[model samples]
Structures are given as structure tokens and as C-alpha cells.
Target: MKRIRSPQKTAEKLLLAVMTLFAAVASVIFLLPTVLTITNSFMAQSEINANYGVVFSSVSGGSKTFISEKVNLKFIPDIVSFSQYFSVLFKTPDYLLKFWNSVILTVPVVIFQTAVALFASYGFARLTGKLKEILFFFYIVLMLMPYQVTLVPNYLVADKLGLLNTRWAIILPGIFSPFAVFLLTKAMKRIPKTYFEAAMLDGASELQIFTNICFPMVRSAVFSVLMLVFIDYWNMVEQPLILLNDEQMHPLSIFLSKINTGDTGLAFAVAVIYMTPSLLMFLYGEEYLVEGITYSGGIKG
Candidate 1:
């Protein structure tokens, strides 16, 4: 007999549809700004001016009330143009230099931090003792401490070491990030101890076992760490602001914040360009990110 769904089931389905629609709306709202930025990057100067003119107009008077009666949010370009991109690439040489500065600053931090974390994690996971637990607890505490708490101490150390206003000022602190160590250690500890025992039987050295066995097992975790560390460093502004007094040495992230209202199109173009590396990184490693989360501590005896 073909049975129809009960009224309760029908009501549950209707409620699910409503919740789904709400979630979709919320997602669209969250992503609207990014969407607008990308679309407006291709918009003509006239269109951008037309849309955002009210917000940018200078009210040079006593006690001026800054209130916009109408706000325009544009998602579609009137005419596709590459003028903004050209302006960024060719018209301004400083922007290119700052872009390179970001690359230089971000890449090394990600690589070195991940490497340090990998080795530290191996030691933590393999070394069996209560001392290891105590050390890891300290790492967690350090990781939990906010940047503001550490900033002054880091500044003191950097000044003492004469590393202020240099790339080393930023790189050194980043290379020893506690969060990376914590995450990598957690993943590495999940690895089976039996693997080490088997590898030892073949006279495999610790380094060899780590490279051939531990690394492959924690590949997803490594990818996750890379993506996270890259993103964090890529968007870093405060460290550079405090560490480097010279504006010329600043990364693209700091410059983006200082962009004025007149350079709306240029801002959009720069934004789109800025997001490309992160977007690409996320796309490539998203699967590993999911895998890392899912398979963490999966090999339980």
C-alpha cells in the first residue's frame, strides 16, 4: 500500500524548508560585501562614483551631520573595465612593491612555523612522560594569551635584540607561534605507537620514521596548518604597524586600510587581487582541512 506522509511529517518538512531558506538568506548577507567588491572591480569609474558618491562627499562645515539618506550597494557592473587593474599594476609602482612585501613576509612565516611545529609535535608525541603533558599545557596557555598581552613583551625582546624595524622582528615571533605547535602536537599524538615499534624493528632512525611514516600520516594536518598560518600572516597588520616604523617596509595589508575614498575602483581591484592567493590556497587545501578535522584522533585503540 502506498502510504501518505502524516501531518506531523508534513509540518516537519515545512519547518526544515523555512530554516533552509533562512540560512541561505543569512549566507547571502554575509557574502554580499565580497560579492560587491569583486563585481565593482570591473565597474566603470562613473558607475562607482554614482553608487558611492554620497558616502565620500566631503562636508566641510561646522558640526556637519554625516548621515546618508540613501545607500547604494552595487553587485553588477554597468560596463566591464580593466582600468583599475592597470592603474594598480602600471600606474602605481608602490602598490607592486607592497604586494611583494606581503609575499615575502607571509611565505617565510608559514614555511618556518610549520617546520618548527612539525619537529616540536614529533617530540611531544613520541616522548612519553608527564613532563610532556606539562610542557604542552604551557603551550596551550601561551596560545590562549591574546596578542595584546604578548605585544609589549615581544617589543621589549625585539628592541633588546636590535631586530626592530626589520623583517626578523615579525618572522622570529611568528616562527615560534604556540597555536601551530598545539595543533600539530594534537594531530601527531593521535598516531599509533605501534607504527614506531614496527619501524624500529627495521633499524629506522627517528628522522627516517618521522619522514616516511609520521609525515604521510599527518599530511592533512600539515595542510591545515599551512592554510591557517598563511591566512593569519597574510592579513597581519598590527605586527608590522608596531614593529616597522618605516611605511615603505609595510606589507600590502597595512596599505589596504589606508586607501582613501577617491580610490574606490582601485580599492575594489586591489581587494580582488589581494584575495586571490588566499582563495587559491583555500580551494586547494579545503579537502585536507576537512580531512584533518575528521580524522583527528581517529586511530584510537
Candidate 2:
């Protein structure tokens, strides 16, 4: 005889189905813009203009009226052209320069920030006292504060140090950001005290334990912090815009807005190039990122 399912089991199954459907829909919604950008980047300039002219025209024209025009959100172009890419990659030296500027400014921040966080986190993890707790609390507070709130202080400090209009203005602040410190400290603290005690008992110095034991255990978290910090600085626009006075020194993130004022198609092409580094980094480190975050939070995976 066929067995009947219980009402509770059926209800649970129904709930699961609903949740899955919601997740799928949300994923699509979130990914739609990225899909659109990648697809539109391949479209010919004429076609891009035809599809988006209504929206851009309104903005450029400085119209105060609400845009009632329906934009043609085409995922596929009638003709796929490489001209935009060709122009952005070859013809536009300025675009390439700005791209390099972004790389120059972002790379140092990622490298130094991770290095600083590693040592600082180690101290916070190993040391125990009211002072350590208080200091860690302050780091958390700084991390929690929105960047906007800290922008003025950064600006003032940069000016006082005569770092205004320089890459150092942005790099210095990012290098000392508290986000990585807080994350790494949490991850390090989760390591059992027995590991350190055993290492010490065996005549391992603090530096040796840090390098051989602590570093190995938290390697995934370090990778996670590197990727996260790289992505954060790579997309920075406000910092460069405010700090660097010379337009030529501004990163691609800032230049992207300027591209919109000119060739709208070029904006899409440049955006694809701009995001390529971040996308590649994320794809490569995705597994490490997830594992790091999981273990750091004391969650078993």
C-alpha cells in the first residue's frame, strides 16, 4: 500500500520550495546588472547609444523632469562589435593610464594592509589584559564607522602631513584600516591555547610559533583578508577624487564617471576592464574566502 505523507512534512516541503524559489529570484535580480554590463560592453557604440540614449540624454541635458521613456534593455546586440574594446584597449592611452593608477594605488594598500593586520592581529590574540580588550574594542568601533564619517578626518590628516594630491594620502589610511585587524584577531583567538603552550614547552620562540603554527592555521583567513582588501581599494573612487587634485593621477574608478559624459559605450568597455582584476581574484579565492570567514566566526564547516 502507498503511504501518505504527514501534514507537517508536506508543509515543511512547501516551505523549502518557497524559500528556494525566492533565493533563485533574488540571485537573478542581483546578477542582472553585471550580466547587462558584460553584454552591453560588446555592443557597437551606435547600438549602445540607440538602446540607452533616452536615459543618458536626459541626464546630460540636465532635465529636472522624471524620465518616462522606456529604455531598451537589450541583452543581445544585433551586431557584436569589438570596436569598443579595441578603442578602450588600444586607442585610449588615458584609459590605460588611469587603470594603472588604480593598480598602483590599490596594490600597495592590499599588500601593506594585510602585512600590518597579520602582526597587529597576532598581538591582540596573544596578549590578554583590560588594555588589550579596550584597544580591540576601539578597533571594532573604527571598523563599524562608515567611511564617510572618517573621510573628513582623513582629509585633515592628509593635509596636515602635506600628503594631499598624492597617492600616499589614500594609501596610508587604507594600510591602517581596522577591518582586517578585527577579522584576523577573531580568527587567531579561536586557535586553542594548547597549541601555543605546546610550542613554548618545546622551546619554540614567539616568532617561531607565529610563523610555523599561527600562520599556517590562519593562512586561509589571511588570503580572505587580502582578496577583500584588494577589492575594497580597487573600487575606490571617493578617496582618489578627494585626495588627488590632478585629474591624470585619478584612478579608473573616478575616470569611469568621466567616460560616461563622453562615449557611453566606452564607459561599459572600461568598466569591464576595471572589474576584471576583482572578478579574477574573487573566483580564484572564493573557496578560501568562504572557509576563512566560517572558521574565523567559530562556525564549523
Candidate 3:
């Protein structure tokens, strides 16, 4: 049997098609930079210079401008080269060292902060009172405050503790992040109290209940926290810059910032490699992130 669509239904379908096409175009426009960075990483040195030499030259006091010269953007290389990748991986020992430094600096923050947030959020969810309300309000206020606002106080504390220039200067401040507490607390509140009551009736201790029940229930939120924390710390520039005086001790984020203007090919390669960890975490944790945020943002008692 064949069914004919009404004119109105056909018009609505055409509208949907147009909207989808518009969105696809918009997405491609937004993703262009990332796509170009990744593709340019494999470009031959000559091709890179041919494409971007004018811009870099302008930065170095040449007279080339976007309006002054014909701009050429390259997504595919005339001849793909792995020299940049090899240089970053083998020829540069410090790049690997700084990459590991980023790993060391980021992993502890993610683990400790998520653990601290989860436990603190569990306590806030279970206990209800005016004092708790006041404290939670403070947490929200602190979370709203900009990172730059706290940077000076944090530096003073680090200086006082003699942790300046050491990884502790970075780790300590990140471990007690307010945003984690706020996010995880919201997730925890969404959990019903009846679950806690049932667990208690079954003689489950607070630790047992937290470990056995609450943690599993909020696994997505935990993953969300880990992803967020990792990305935040992985791309950190200011903390390392302000806290660590020694360039050798800097993370890859700071290292990337110091990339030589002449080494554009190496810079692009490093950028791609540097972006991989956060990319992987985001891809894997994306579903958890969405679900966690949805639950956290919903109305709760």
C-alpha cells in the first residue's frame, strides 16, 4: 500500500531537512580549527611554510597581514611527512619529560579531588541542617568565584608551606576544588533517602552503604568529575606558570606555550599528541558526563 503525504506534512519535512543541513554546516565551521590543526600536523615542512609563513612572518615584524596577502589554508598535505612526529617523540627528550610531568600533575588532582568531592557530597546529602546549608551556600559562592580571584591567596599559602616550585603547589589547590564539591553534591542529592533507610535497616554501616550503594548509583557523576578535573588540569597554564619558577619543572601545557616560532611543524605535532589524553577521556566519558549533568541539574528535594 502507498500513502500520499499531505502538503503540510511535506512542508514540515522540507523545513526539517533545511534545519539539519544548516546545523551540519555550522558544526563543520566550528570544527574547522581542530580539523586543520590535526591535518596540518602531518604536513610537510615546505607546505606548512607555504601556507602559514606569512602569518608567522608578520608576527616577527614582517608586513604580511590577512588583508595584505592571499590566505591559503591546507587540510591535506601535498606530501605527508612523519618527521615532526619523530622529532617530538624521539629527538626531544624534554618533551617526553614534560608530558610525563603533565600526567603526574593531572592524575593526582583527578583522583584526590573526585574522592574528596564524592565523600563530601555524600555527607552533605545525608546531613541536613542550617550549618550545612550555610556551608553549602559558601561552597556555591566559592565555585562561582573566578580562579584568578583565588590565585594570589593560593600562591601565599603555597609560599608559606614552602611548596612553591614543587608539584604540591599545583596538587594541593586542585585537590579541594569547589566546583567538584558543587557538582557531586548536586548529583548526590538526586539520590533518594529511602535507599539509605533501606540499607540501614539491613545493618549496613555508613561506609558500607556509601561504598556499596551510593558510589555505584553516582558512578556517572564520578566519571563526569574525573573527566572535568582531568581536562581542567591537563590544559592548565597559569598554575604552573605562577607556582613553578623552574622551566624544567613545567608541564606540557607550559611547554607548548614556549614552542619556538620557527618550529611550527613540531608545534602542530605536539599539539595533536598533547590533545590526545583529554580527547580520549572526553570520548569515553561523554555519555556519563551528559547523564550526570542532567541528573544534577534536575529538581531535587
Candidates' C-alpha lDDT: 0.88, 0.90, 0.88
Model 2 bad stretches (over 4 Å) = 58-67, 297-301
TM-score of each: 0.92, 0.94, 0.90
Ranking according to lDDT, highest score first: 2, 1, 3
lDDT tens digits, residues 206-277, model 2?
999999999888988999999999988888878987889999899998888777767899988899998889
Each model's RMSD to truth, in Å? 2.5, 2.0, 3.0
> Of the candidates numbered 1 and 2, which has the greater TM-score value?
2
Q: How many steric overlaps are in each model, in order?
A: 0, 0, 0
Candidate ordering by TM-score (highest first): 2, 1, 3
**Residue 171 error, candidate 2, Å:** 0.6
The alpha-carbon deviation from the true structure for residue 106 of candidate 3, after best TM-score superposition, in angstroms, is 0.9
Instruction: Give the alpha carbon lDDT tens digit for every residue of 163-217 in model 3.
Output: 9999999999899988899998888788778889999999999999999988887
- TM-score, predicted candidate 3 vs. hidden true structure: 0.90
Q: What digit string (tens of lDDT, one per residue) describes model 1 on residues 1-301?
A: 9998999999999999999999999999998988988998999778888888566665565233556568788788878999999999999888888999999999999999999999999999899889989999999999999888999999999999999999999999999999889888889888888999999999999999999999988888889899989999999988999999999999999998666445777888898888989999898889998887677534634
- Provide the lDDT at 137 for model 2: 95
